[model samples]
Target: MDVSLKNRFLKSYFSFSVGIWFSAIISFLSVPITSWLIEPAEYGKATMFSTIYSMILLIVLIGTPNGFMRLYHSVEEKRKLLWSSLVVPVFLSVIFFGFVLLFKDTVNIFLAGQKNSKAHLILVFAVFFGVLQTFSQTVLRMQEKGFSYSALQIVSAASNVLFVILYALLISRNFYAVLYAQLFSNILALSLGIYLHRESWFPIKIDKSLVKEILAYSYPFLLSGVVWWLFGWTDRIVLRMYSTFEEIGLYSAAFKLVSVMSLFTSGFSTFWYPFAYEQYEKNPNNKELFSKTFDYISFLILILALLIMSAKNVIFLLFAKSYRSSAYIAPFLLLQPVAITMAIVVARGIDFAKKTYWYIISDGVAAAFNIIGNLLLIPLLGAKGAAVTTGLSSIIVFAIEKAASEKLYPVKYNSKRAYVSMLILIIIASINTFFERFYVGILSSLTGIVVVTLLYNDVFRKLMKSFFEFLNRLKSMNK
Candidate 1:
């Protein structure tokens, strides 16, 4: 990589990542705090509300956010493109909101695990506002307004924490606190998002032909979205069926801890799509950048996964004693983000080639595997079963996506070392789960670290040399 290009990529990445890290830190801290305030069953019920919200968001958006990003630089009328993306999703969101109202009783039971009309209404509004927020964020993302985007993210996360504290202090301290806090926070975040992108999306007007074009590109993702949801959330749904809310709560807690991995994944994905698309447009044949990026990301994510797995017990200590068992479940759950982050890098070819349909096949197969795994395993092992199933399903998704992408636009990614590192991390996770001893975790972590370091020795040397050179440059500037 050129020095200038490397500097630009690092600057852009940190511009987005800094905010994500702060927001994630707040969210990370809040998980234990919320766990302390709410019981396991109540926390589990709150998780269900988010589950329903995510499903509705997926249906209403129908993948238009991605369509907008893909077409952003290609189109001259970028504002019109933004408006085109928003119109249909907002319309669909209204219809879904109405449906929620019409079928309030059923939605209440399914979403809240009980019939609370107020909570149901709040969830409906949350999804509605969330649609607007999605487009607003996408606009910032596509435009590379990293600072503004990061500010919005931080504000949203902070407000949610504040509201959760307020609700617990003044309002009822049950699942309602969680549900209500989310609704209020979404409203606040949506308002800020609209304000941030006001110049881009205000005076919005429909572009019928453009809307049709964007929809054509994004429609496959609609089917894929549903399947993707199934792949991601089937464990929760299955857990709801076969296990207690307490078990679900424990699982959700573990999942939240694992989501610290998403701090990097989400920030990277948010940046990757726009960056990758732009790079492809400029040099369609430059495969080395993609290959090198994949190797570096895989190396970082694998190392992070191992470290998190080793520290799971210590991390879970912040949770209430009732949630302590979550430590065991969290190690394998690390795979979910690892797969997602790497897939964004490895599967860039699919998006570049406009082969969105591959997502359907990849997610469909994984979802099927997950459904069967959950059915068989949740019956026997409870939350641990779900964690293991999710981990394995993630690998399936990554493998299928990588193969499809390679067929579309071949990149000679040096994947052998990544695979070896992943295997070592998996073994360490399994040991940590079964042994549950501090010394055992330490020994396994040390072993995995040694093996991964040896495997990626060349990459590490390059990074270290770059770091010292960067430091020398700083010293020269100071002089």
Candidate 2:
């Protein structure tokens, strides 16, 4: 890529990353406080509610967000495209809401894993608001309104923390605190999102043919979405069967810690999606740019993984004594976000070719592996088993998607380096999880970092060169 393109990429990435990183920092700060306020069992119950909410959101949205994003630039009638993308999902969500109300008893038992009518109703409304909020943010992302998008993210995260604290202290100190905080936070964020993007989506225009076309492209992902959800959440669901809510809570805590890695993944995806589609539209065979971007991202993600592993013990000290055991489970869960983020670049070819169904094959196989692994391993190893299963399943998904993407749109990525780095990551994670020696983790992580840096020395050299060039430009402009 040229210097100008590199500058644009960095500018856009940091714009998104600033908000995401702030949001992550706030969430990280709140984790210790929240874990103190709510017990492990309560946290586990809240996790269940979130899991159900995600399933409903997936079903009602029917992959419309992806469709809207994919077609945004291609379609001239932007407002109509927005309306068409949202109308069906809104209709489906309403129907699903009514169905949930009608079968409240069964849903309360099966979905929330508890019999609470108020919580069930709260969850139903959450899904409704979630759909609107999701699309509103998507609009901000597609328009490249990075500041507005970042503001929305910051507000959402901050508000959630405040609400959780207030609800826990003033109202109740149980799972309801978590659930109500999310519901209200969504309302606040959604309201702000609509206000921010009002001009773009106002005077909603619905086109029947446009709706059909968008759905035609997006509906396949509905199946893929289900399997993808399974791929991501099956470990937690299966763990619920073999373990106690306390174990689930510990596992969830570890997952939350590992989710900090999402700062990179979320920021990258938010910027990369629209950016990638726009670039591909301009030049279909821009393989070098894509390959180099992948290498840089992979290096960064691996380095972050090693650092997190090295600091696992120190980070876990923030949590309460009951939750500290989560340190053991935190290392491998890093793979989930790392793999998902890397796949954003490596798997763009699938979206570029519009082969949405390939998602099913990749996610389905990984989800299947997760289910079996959790079933067999959770019985013997409990939460650690689920963690191990998740790490391995993530790798499976990444490998399959990378290969498929190569066949469709061949990018000459340095696979040997990626694979070797991943191998080193697994070894370091294993040592950290199984052994209590702090020095052992530090030594392994340092060694892994050195080896990875050596493997990507070219990326480092190019980045250094770019930095000096950027500095020279600044100096000349000043003179």
Candidate 3:
């Protein structure tokens, strides 16, 4: 990498990292606070409400945000592209809203189950704002406005904490309070997001040709998004069907704790797509660059997985007593993010090539397997089964995506290094989950550090070299 480009990348990276870390902390604090305030069953139901909005957002947007990001590279009129993406999705959302009203009774029964239909209705509005929130964030990212993007995230996270605290303490301490806080926070962020990207909203032109192009690029992505949702959320849904709300609560709590991995994945991911796509565009056949990037990402994820599993006890302490089973579930659930990180590394091929149908294939296969796995496993093993199934399903999806992507853009990743790191992680995680001893956790942490270091010594050396060089350059420039 050129020194100037590398420096700029690092600057953006640190900006994003700091912002995301702050956001993660707010989220981390909020989880326990929310868990503490509500009953386990209520918390579970609240989580389900969040999932309901996620499903609705997936349908309403139809992957247009993704196409918007990718197509921004080629589109001449950025505002027009934004208009097309927003207009079509908003139109679809309106139609979907009508359908919701028409089938209010049936939809309420299906989604709300024994809960109140009124909350689900509020979530419909939340879904609309949430879609806008996502679309606006994508525009910020595509424009490479990392600082603004991070600021928006900080505001969202802070507002979420504030609103949830207010509702829980002053107003109500029920699941509805949690949902309402989230809904209001999203609205706040959506409004701010629109203001930030206000340029994209105006002179609204419904460009039929642009909409057609965006849909063409995003069509496969739509299916992939649904399948990805299933891959991610089906476990909870199936578990809800087979188990009690307490179990769902436990699983959800554990999942939230393990999202420590997502802090890293998402923070880097915020910077990665734009960076990776730019790198690919600059030199399409730079196979080694992609390969080395994948290796580094894989190593980082493994290290994070190890640390989180080792510190499960510390994480569990933050939760209420009723949610403590989340500690044991955390180790297995941590693997899900590792798999996701790996998938992100390899999925770039399909993304860059615009062969997003491969994403559908990979996500679909794993989602189907996960649903079946959950049905079988949740009946026998309960939450643990769901966690294990989620991990394995993600791993399978990563493998399939990597295999498919390599055929299209043959990045020569160090497969042995990645595979071995993953295998060691699996062994260490299994030990931590099953053995459940402080010594085992300690030993596994040490082993993970040593093994990963030995496996990626070259990468580490280069990373250190780059760091020192960067520091020296900074000092010289100051002088």
Candidate 4:
């Protein structure tokens, strides 16, 4: 049973991991051509608009998807629950978009919103597409069709490259052009998702009781979403608020670099809830399952951290002449994956407990910490301040969530190994932090990761077995 489960996870993990890398690759491919077509300022505006759009999405969805994940496994009431949970977000989305269409000017000055008054209508359409797109994709993720889901995502992503290249190179640089492309991508994704995972959505009906339960679960993120996004996005918006577009450009580049960590965590974390829920189903009372999940995930994060620290300089230097600032922040950014992985861990426990309120409260606290940190730090430190605040906030959040998870579940999180692993990471971070040089520290970090990875002989043996099995699976497919 364990072997089969582990194998499945490895396959799922690998697929999602490759999907992330592919998405990154496609984005890079589109970049030079797109940049040649549109000025940085225009591209920056589009990026900023999307960020605001995502923030607005929080209100429209009002915690539905997050709530859905938290409560779906517990929903005995079922169908009405699904319908009930979805209705509010959909209705609210329409209403909110309508308001934005109406009050275009007020949105910018008062709402901390975007300045693109002319593109407000297209923005609404894009946001609506985004909500529907998320709803459809969430259904597939819940169904555990990892390979099919990833393929659907890849198709949309690849299409994005085509459209971006076409629009940027051959068409207008109007923000709506980008918006139209995004809307099309979402439409394609929704279509592909519905086509591939037709089973879960069908015969779908409302469950009032289940809906209430899920809403209750999601209520936390709904609240947390607002504050969480504000803090998450505050640095960028604040830069626009306080500084010039040119300064915003530098900050945007740095922010884009850090978002890589989020991408890395997204797939793993997306699968995490379902994975945990499944384990709990199989062994409802097995503390070992939770402990093992945490350890395995922690170990994985450690490996990634080591790799990022090692490769930060070479990667940024290789990517673009303008993106040199990434090296300055990548090490600090690398530390973020640890906190992020732990946040997901906490979120998993919170999700399973059906205590959605805790999720909101915890996020609120973390958001508060970030906001205060940014306000105090950004004025003094600038772009680096933003990075520092983000990294520290992640750690603070992880610590808080870990405490909360411990309280609710009362399991050993295998912290002794975690502590040792973190100590090694800290040494690497400190070396870089002190010298503020990439090469020597990077080499040291790379060497340390190798030496430490070797320490777990049992782990290495298991990894080799898994690798061979994966290779064999590929070999059989070729036959």
**Candidate maximizing lDDT:** 2
Instruction: Order candidates by lDDT, high to low.
Output: 2, 1, 3, 4
lDDT of 1 at 253: 91
- Collision count for each candidate, in order: 0, 0, 0, 8
Could you tell me the lDDT of residue 125 within candidate 1? 81
Per-model TM-score, in order, reads: 0.90, 0.90, 0.89, 0.87
**Model 4 accuracy (lDDT, Cα):** 0.69
- lDDT, each prediction: 0.85, 0.87, 0.80, 0.69
In model 2, the clashing pairs are none
Q: Which wins on TM-score, candidate 3 or candidate 4?
A: 3
| Tens digit per residue, CA lDDT, model 2, 42-143 | 897898899889888999999999999998888888899999999999999889889988989888776456676577788889999999999998888888
- Once all C-alphas are superposed, what RMSD does model 2 give against the true structure? 2.9
Q: After superposition, how far is residue 195 of candidate 3 from its true place, in Å?
A: 2.5
Off by over 4 Å in 4: 76-81, 105-118, 168-171, 237-263, 319-325, 375-381, 447-461, 464-479
lDDT of 3 by residue, 1-479 (tens): 56686677778777677778888888867776877787877776787778788888888888888788787777778888888888778888788778878777776666556534676577678877887888878877777788888888888889887887788889778777778878887888778878867887777766889999888888888898888876777887888899998888898888876777888888788877877776787788877767777877787788778877777877788777888767777777887889888788788888777888988898889988898999999999889889888888888888999998888888777887887887887787777767767787778877887899889998788878988987999999999
Taking all chains together, the TM-score of candidate 1 against the true structure is: 0.90
Query: lDDT at 167 for candidate 4?
Result: 76
Candidate 2, which segments miss by more than 4 Å at Cα? 32-46, 105-116, 165-177, 240-249, 321-325, 467-479
* TM-score of model 4 vs. true structure: 0.87
- In model 1, residue pairs whose N, Cα or C atoms come closer than 3 Å (at least 3 residues apart or on different chains), thus clashing, are none
